[model samples]
Structure formats: structure tokens, C-alpha cells
Target: MVDVTELQRQHIEKITKEKKLITIKECSTLTGIGERKLRELVHVSGFPCIRFGKKCMIVSSLIDEWLINHIGETF
Candidate 1:
């Protein structure tokens, strides 16, 4: 049987693999945007992301540029 905690650990490991690509959690930490809000923002056009299975891998640079464009130059 698959333990729930084990599944969660794998998910965490997948999301935090340490690279230029990062997960919603890391993006949220860097951008101060809530994870749920970040997920919603993903549906917007031209939001840079990659999908591996069910995980949404966000590019740190793209999100930064996105915020600056959408929010304001001050962002």
C-alpha cells in the first residue's frame, strides 16, 4: 500500500528539485503571491510554465517579467 506521507514526500521532492525551474511554492516565496492565486494566474495567456505530470513548473525569470508587465514597472 502506498502511504499518504510517502506520496506527499515524492510530490515535495518533485517540486523542490533545485534548478532554474521551480514550483508554485518557491515562486510564491519569491514573488509573495499566494499559491492559489499563482495557480489562477497560470490560466492567463503567456504565463511561462512547464508541465510534468500534474505539477506546474514555473520559470523564475518569466514570472518576474510577467509581474513587472502586468502589475507595473515598480513591481
Candidate 2:
């Protein structure tokens, strides 16, 4: 049987190393935004995205820019 803990650890390591792109869940966590809100912002405001096969990933750099630009401003 596969070791679930090892699998999770590997997944975490992969994500940490590939910081350029992230899932909606990761983006929401990093930006402190709800998943629904993040999706709306990405769709309406043209938030940066990186398409990988069938998945849509957000660029971490763009999230950093958004955070810097919106710092101290109420969401």
C-alpha cells in the first residue's frame, strides 16, 4: 500500500518548489480571500492565470502585486 503521509509530504514539497503557479485554494489562502471572491476577481478583473492542461492556476507574483497595491485598503 502507498504511504499517505509520504504522499502528502511529497505534494507539499512539490508545491513549495513550484511557487510560480498555485490553485484557487492556495491563492485564496495566500490572499486571505474567499474562493468565490477570488474567482469573481479573476473573472471580472482579469487577474493573472496560468493554464496547465485542464487546470487554471494563478500566478504568485500577481498575487504579490495585488497584495502590495491593496495594502491598507479595505477589501
Candidate 3:
């Protein structure tokens, strides 16, 4: 069971890294940020997200860029 959970985590990491767009839940998993936090961030100005109806998708590369750009900033 532990091994299976590890494999599932690895698979999620791979998908998060490889996919151009990822769901909020995937972003939360990848970033270790809560889904609720991600949902709030998605609504913030300049957050990198695409909305399809009520669902939101995050741009993976943009997240990287956002992280880089935020380096040294106090949260």
C-alpha cells in the first residue's frame, strides 16, 4: 500500500511537470498548496489560470515563472 501510494505520488508529479495545463487540484498537489488557497489565488489579479465555465486550469509554466518572480518576496 505504501509503495502504491508512492507510485501514485510520482505519477502525479510527472503529470504536473509534463502537462501544459493542470487542474486546481493537480496544482495543489504539485505545489503543496491547499486547493482552497489555489482557488483564491486563481481569482487574484495576474494569476496564471484559464477558466472553463466554473472550472479553472493553471498554466504550469506560468506557475514556475510566478515562483521565480516571487523569489525573495515575503508572503
Error of 1 at 48 (Å): 1.2
After superposition of all CA atoms, the RMSD between model 2 and the true structure is: 5.5
| Highest lDDT model number | 3
> Over the stretch 1-75, how does candidate 3's per-residue lDDT look in tens digits?
268878878988788678999998888877888998888888777889999999889998789788678779644
TM-score, cand. 1 vs. native:
0.66
Each candidate: RMSD to true structure?
8.2, 5.5, 2.5
Of 1 and 3, the candidate ranking higher by lDDT: 3
Total backbone collisions, model 2? 0
Off by over 4 Å in 3: 1-9, 72-75
Q: Give lDDT tens digits, candidate 2, residues 27-58.
A: 77565689988766665454688666767788
- What is residue 54's positional error in candidate 1, in angstroms? 1.3
TM-score of each: 0.66, 0.57, 0.74
Quick one: best TM-score, which candidate? 3
What clash pairs does model 3 have? none
User: What's the CA error at residue 19 for candidate 3, in Å?
Assistant: 1.7
